[model samples]
Target: MKPTLKPLAEQVIVITGASSGIGLATACAAAEAGARVLLIAREDKDLRPIVAEIVASGGTADAFAADVGDAARLRAAAAHAVQRFGRIDTWINGAGVAIYAALRETPAEEHEQLFRTNYFGTVHGCLAAIPHLERGGALITIGSIAGDMPSPLMGAYAASKHAIKAYVEALRMELGEAGLPISVTLVKPSGIDTPIAQHAANHEPGEAQIPPPVYDPKLVAQAILHCATHVKREITVGGAGRAQALFAAHFPALFEVLAPKAAASFIDPARPQPRPDNLFASVRTGRIRSGEHHARRTSFYTTAAEYPGTTAVIGVGLAAGLGALIASRHRTRH
Candidate 1:
């Protein structure tokens, strides 16, 4: 039988990369929804303020600093959350890193680091959280559209996401074969307005920006919160992302021609080259939002992803209405 997930109010949610971006957004949303939140990140200084803010706002939250890339440390964080809250209802593996440069320019060690954090980190989180999760618990990982489609500058990050997608699929199948009552959801967001670009290690000239049609991080947060209680196989966040995935699925050759054009425009040629990077170490303090470069508007992709039946119904209704109008016009002409 399928698992029946508990609502956020009754959940004890442990989130990695909770100090910033989508992870931070989800942490706050879960806390606001009455979940006991355990926020983990590499820096305590970053996690402390966010936790304090949530608690000050009458939410239950605590910070545990750890690098998700470190298996033992991440496992310890999971154990601490279980110890503090009794049990963990959901584990969100949201920690990841990105690199913006040509594949040739990127060093072997940087690629290794990307996989270490993005892939191995997720593996660790899953292993640590599984034993403590009762029936109906969830494991949500934040993947990227890059996992589905190729892009130019973020080759390593994309590769890591692809690995994550495969790993999650395998884990999901294993859990089902074992008849364990748990849900695994992979959330693939398009370009999201997060501080990730600021934190990424860049080899390119100008700053690295998320590809166009960026969706708000809150949209991603909403999806994460939904998956905490509901079972969704996977959901892509932005319209552009969904479009690329579909296009790539049906027309790979055409996408290959178009994708690089899209990628090339991501960086401004006029922008100063040789900018600062954050790959080897933490250069900036963690924050909830990034710069104002990304779009402030939400995407219809969120609605379509979260509520497919409703979207289909709406599509059908519009088609019927258009058909009726055409019929009326024909009658008038007659």
Candidate 2:
């Protein structure tokens, strides 16, 4: 079921990777909902406009420059939020990188980079905010559907998500027992039609291959706000994302059958290095497109991100599973 817009007069939220895509869209939505928004990205290069946009819309927002992978930076951002907003009621980490490589061929550096951005980045946000995070606040992580099932070429990204799931689940359990309002949430988006695919890292020369999926980014963004309004413990956003998550849980045989085809779409060529382009990158989508039934966020216990096989994730998720269709940095005529 779809959820109606809720008021956010007294809420404050900090979102990482707010310069573009899901992070950017979500920041806009949060501000419109009446919350005081804190935006953080790896650089100030793209933040000024975002900050100005929010402020111009009769909402409150501020941008801070910081890399999600940097613990020190996140700490400072978190500290800044408290001092500026008086308190932080919500935290969302949307910064991520999709690297192409096989389990054996995947380099230690790439693995570390993916983990830093996808996994530990979330961790840093949580850790930095925990002390001042407030008992009644919420912690939200933007995870992929790949976390549950094994994707062929995108192993590291999936692995990082698995790690995130493990951490958030445990955090939820602990917080529940502690009777704290500090609820933990994981948002698993399907093929968000976002520019994440465009920005994804390719193999050096020839690495591996995979298939692509599709979904809407704004839908994912709306679903996120859905969670924030109600603050559900965990939510899988959108239709395809939910299906992929279900595949990991209820139907392994089907997952195995479909996994390789999706993987081969991106990484099976076994090239000496990675391919720079995302074969499944969709046609440019810009301007306001209206559609019925804006996707809803539910308290549904959807599946966790889990693509163990390296190849499966690359194709099915990186290529096939698209979530948001918006790209702040795209060259499309707006």
Candidate 3:
């Protein structure tokens, strides 16, 4: 069994992108763990319910509507967190957008849009909240396994997450060097049991061929709440997640050899971009509708009991991994 993550009494957590998925789960988990939560996401309608849920359940929560990538809004959010609660104990950067297309095939604006949200969002969040960080405060951001290993169909999205990993690692070092009271931890999770990929944006509307590897968002959220209480170098969710992270870190050749298969099993090329009916440029919700993906009953790769999810595919990854090893040896000899 994984080590149990403990309670955080009276501390405050500010989670960006709290309206759905992991952010939403984290907010609930943190509040359940006895911490005050300030939820930030683009939509107030979505953010409000969670706050209301917490408040209704006798947990303290406040919802703030903002684009985490916006400097002014993030700065304001930091202040709001401080005002709402005495100190900023944990700040989570969770709101992200995925723009997955072949490099040359992707539009410039689309490319910029990813970086603006995934990378800049975290930067803005950190910038705003760091000033008010307490002695044991934590700065957490979600990075993908795609960020660590090269993902073909997800180049743009992966690059943005890759940049996030770089940013947090460097920030950790710099803060440690300066002896700041703040502690920063990065989370690299695999495919989650959420609507993230389903809601992924693409050039057209349809399913695309993807890769095999996957991990659950609920599991990642569980791991995230764990990190908030216990600051460590990194906490990767799921079993294959840690292995993949290891492959990317120590064996580039192994990771390279595995990339195509990885993409095939994991990347859903058939998944279409958010060509929404509205003009507001909202992110696609894919299979999971916004305000509809409830986390109370969510779990990794599958819901608590609805249907078998990603875990059902574990055997496939093992087979692919073995195949990748054989392919690697053959290439080395050639």
* Candidate with best TM-score: 1
- Candidates in descending lDDT order: 1, 3, 2
* C-alpha lDDT of all candidate models, in order: 0.86, 0.69, 0.70
lDDT of 3 at 180: 79
- State the local distance difference test value for candidate 2: 0.69
| Per-candidate RMSD, Å | 2.0, 13.6, 10.0
Q: Is candidate 2 or candidate 3 better by lDDT?
A: 3
Model 1: runs farther than 4 Å from truth? 272-276, 294-296, 321-334
TM-score of each candidate structure, all chains considered together: 0.93, 0.75, 0.77
Better candidate by TM-score, 1 or 2:
1
- For candidate 3, write residues 208-308 as lDDT tens digits: 32233444355766767767776566766654655666777898887778776656544434544335421124443222223323323333422211123
In model 2, what lDDT does residue 308 have? Answer: 24
